[model samples]
Target: MTSPDARMLASQNIVLILCGNKKDLDADREVTFLEASRFAQENELMFLETSALTGENVEEAFMQCARKILNKIESGELDPERMGSGIQYGDAALRQLRSPRRTQAPSAQECGC
Candidate 1:
């Protein structure tokens, strides 16, 4: 992830997730979990190991990413009004998503965090 392309995205304030998929294949692993964890920690990124076959942590990865993005938007770090911010309230869910009642962040139990 230290590549130039990744750096360009970081320059754009993109929220990145370092996902190591196929977590069920522990026997054929080439990279260690500690290595990935250290890299993610050093880079200030969200990381997860998911398994498509077992459906483990797959949904959690997406949910975590969405939560981070929503938090960023709520904190005014990411502006939905700004172009290229990669954030927008869709027309179908706009009203519900932007409802004033949803101002508070979800509880840990609610978010499964």
Candidate 2:
């Protein structure tokens, strides 16, 4: 989390997914599933094991990430209108109200999803 690259990627409230690659070679794994899962949990990232050859969990991973990103947008945790979030919504949605304290989660009504 302290790495500069990781910080940069997370700066815009971007959702992060951690995929452990090479699932087809489970016996030859460089990192175990449990270890990677623990790391993903500690880093607060969505976890998946994928195999390009087998096409395992690849689409599901993308779908899960997209779902969470949309949820973040709906929940007002992310603002695509803000610069550098790399997100855009086509339809008109009312912006979420900013709380003065910046501690409380915005209400669903407030977000206007």
Candidate 3:
């Protein structure tokens, strides 16, 4: 199937994050990524990829999506006061998303090297 039109998709405030289940098939799905990325880049729609099996770049992918959504809101792409305006995300959701995660970083206590 052909990739969805980015222009049309970007007109709305919806960001589509598509993750390919099979790594082997991802290469064949270049057109989809190309179209999606192009649409995101041109219209500031967030597009990203992640791997649940490998847990690769999963956080970054979601963060990128969040960032894009935030940017869209900041840019007035979607009305903040208007609920569900063209798939508008809630401020509370964004606030939770922007909150810092409590992750312990590697320190000398944990690393002998």
Best by TM-score: 1
Better model by lDDT, 1 or 3?
1
Native-to-model Cα distance after best TM-score fit, residue 88 in candidate 3, in Å: 6.1
Q: Please list the residue runs of candidate 1 whose C-alpha ends up more than 4 Å from where it truly belongs after superposition.
A: 9-11, 92-113
Residues 41-72, candidate 3, lDDT per residue (tens digit)?
77544455556767776788778777766767
Itemize residue pairs with steric clashes in candidate 1.
none
Candidate 3 regions exceeding 4 Å error are 1-11, 24-47, 86-113
Task: Arrange candidates by TM-score, descending.
Answer: 1, 2, 3
Give the alpha carbon lDDT tens digit for every residue of 6-113 in model 1.
Answer: 767653657778888889999999889999999999987889998999999999998998888777776678777777777776785563544333647888769735
Clashes of each: 0, 0, 0
CA lDDT of every candidate: 0.79, 0.76, 0.60
TM-score of each: 0.75, 0.69, 0.45
